[model samples]
Target: MKRVVFAVPGSLDTPTGGYAYDRRIMAELRQLGWDVECLDIGDGFPLPDEATRSAARSLLLEVPDGLPIVVDGLALGVLPDVAAEVASRHPLLGLVHHPLALEWGLSAERTDALHRSEQAALALVREVVVTSPTTAKLVASDYGVSADHITVARPGSDPAPRSRGSRSEVPHLLSVGTVVPRKGFDVLVAALATLAALPWQLTIAGDLTRDPNEAAKLDASISQHKLAGRVATPGAVSSERLAVLYDSADLFVLASRYEGYGMAYAEALSHGLPVIGTTAGAIPDTVPQEAGLLVAPGDVAELAEALRRVIADAELRRRLSEGALASARTLPTWQQSGAIFAAALEKLA
Candidate 1:
């Protein structure tokens, strides 16, 4: 039996796309009869430090030499010591949701630093697994990594839309993600402003990361737009509440300037909710022509128009909802993801 270790930034308690990916992958691999282990390198934001690097190295040393190890690109990018240690022994595999350097909003200094760090980390990895082709291309063009070395293995969703709710009377608009600038909540707000005459309510759900400044900005935006009654930002909801939100919502909007792979989009579609997203990053892969609407990034007018179309036309919403749900049911599970991953690992073995 082969032993596989997945290195991540933190525990499953604090959810992030990278964390979800690792958790699902480990679960699926375990089901497949591989001896699976997850090594949490510590959490918070930014990146790991020297002590975390030491912890990763300690974990690496514990794994037998030549073992297949998958490193979370989130924490690994910033840890050159960890990269150096992994390079000396195991065949390193990188699972990058998206490169930190390519995140939508970052200062020039931080972007450059992340770029340097990611380049160093990529140098040690034998294979790079990303959630989308956009990231695969970014890794090749920005980091000079070979495209052939990178594989795109996207995430799948299991949606549960509510059947009892009256969709016509209460048009629900849902947006999910950590309240961050890159996710484009500001753009969503701007779009909502355009639809002020409409009776629809918008719900924003996700952990508001402990950054007070960003939180203040989001609060101020909601106030400035005077969206108090119509907009809801219930920070950090449970999975059950999220499913309820998806079930009740008429449409899901992701105004992100960029995404590695829009898992929420898939989740919304799975719940039979039509999606509205920008034509940026991997979102195009999930939002089929019949399932959702795509607008140019930051185009509030376009989003508002799309919102109006979906809200006013019952037939259009019903058609797209059916299409989206069908698409979701057809999506691969994490077990399937593991099987494909195992095939990739076989070549290296």
Candidate 2:
């Protein structure tokens, strides 16, 4: 049997797109007849203490020599020394969602450190797997990885029924993502505050616990704008509930600062919902011009203007909805993603 170790940080059940991609791809690889063993390297990764670092090193050392092992970028990016030590003994494949240096809210020094570390770690890997072409290009250009050594296996979206839309007198906007600075819920709230005169309601569904300070700031902003009655934050939700939200939402919005792959945007398209997002990262690639409007990240005025146009013009919304459905049809399925991912791994074997 073709066996490999998939090293990931923390639990596989985390409610995040990256984790979801890892879990789904691992399962699919197993179905393809590869013996994929998962190795959880604990939490506080990319900023691990000495003890955590030692543990990760020990775990990697335990793997049999010459076996291929896939390491999640979140953990591997910060462990250049450990990765360097392991590279000679095993075939290391890096599965990077995005570079850790690109994460939002980092000090200049920290960003530089992560960038250097990630570049060093990636240099030692035999090949790198990215979720989007944007990231593949990034790894080649910024991290010094050769283009030929990179593989892009985009995330897959499930087929969903088109949204019936909200019956409320006002339009219902839905945003899904963990409440982190990167997700830019703060920017979304600031934009929505400007559109208070319009008849629209918003519900943000995400894990508030992921970043409590950011969540608290959002709550304060909602209250300060006197939009307490117009917005809802339901925290983390189940897959079934998220599907229901998509079905009922008039529009799907997320003003994320960056995205390695905008899974939520694709999910919105699957439900035939118009998107209101930024032109950050891979968003423009995922959301077509006809399907929605994209403004520069952190541009509150532009976001508000886009929101106003969509709120007042039902015809424009209809056109975008049709466009969304068209775009969704072009998205790759999970099964297809698995095949691509399997092919990438098989090459190493």
Candidate 3:
């Protein structure tokens, strides 16, 4: 069995989307009888200091020479020097969900730092595996990584858990993602304000980070729109609870301005729920045309119309729900992700 080192800067215990992706990938790889070692490089935030860089180097100390390493772009992109050193010694492949420079809400200084880090990280890696073609293009164009060196591997969703007996009163409109500016929650709130008469409840499930001002803005928007009764912002829901949310919801709306990959959109589709999202980033790739409606980013009127349409037309909902579920079956499983990852490793190893 080949041994592969998977490095990232987040705890496996956290409920983050990147961590979730790593966990799934690790499990699938292990099941295939590959030896996988996980390394936490610490959170790649506010730029890593000297201590963090030392810690990263230390974490790599035990990794076997010539073994293939799968490095998270988010983590490695912040520590370009460390990445370069590690890849020089071992066969390193980058697993980029998206580039940090393209992330929303980043300041010019941080973006510059991220771009520099990313350029360095890509320099050290033999190849990169991105979650979507959109990201692959960015890697090639932005980082100057050759197209042949990048692979696009999308994710699949868990099986829909047993339905928590359907609710009859209100149609559930669910949005699952971190509550940040990138998610376009403000736009969603504005759109919801236009549809006060609809008997639908919008549930926003995500972790609220350290940004108090952003949180305050979201809170104020909810209150101002008088959507306090209609919209519920439950911070950091458990996966089991999230599964329940998916099962219970009548529709899923992801008004994200951009995404590396819309994993929640796949989850919603797997649950046989129709999705409504903007044509941003990998959303258009993840959400099948038959499963939902796609609109321009920040288009409140279009979003409102889509929401209204989903809520009022039962037949349309049923058709979309069925189509989404059917379309989801065609998505690649985690095991496939593992196989693809292993294949990438094979090229360098």
Best by TM-score: 2
lDDT minimum window of 10 residues, candidate 2: 340-349
| TM-scores vs. true structure, each candidate | 0.92, 0.98, 0.94
Residue-by-residue lDDT tens digits, candidate 2, 183-298: 98889999998887889999999999978899899999999999999999999999989988988999999999999998999999999999999999988889999999999998
lDDT (Cα atoms) of all candidates against the true structure: 0.78, 0.92, 0.83
Candidate 2 or 1, higher TM-score: 2
What lDDT score is found at residue 114 in candidate 3? 87
lDDT of 3 by residue, 218-250 (tens): 999999988898889888988778878877788
Clash pairs detected, candidate 2 = none
Clashing pairs in 1: 162-247
Candidate 1 lDDT tens digits, 1-349 = 9787887777766755656777777777778888877877676434556676667678777887888888888877887667787778888888888888867668999999999988988988888888877888888998878887887777755446533234457688889988777788888888788778877888999778645576678888889989988888898898888778776777788898888898888878777777788898888877887888899887888878888888777788888888887888877777777776766666556
Give the candidates in order of lDDT, highest first: 2, 3, 1
Better model by TM-score, 1 or 3?
3
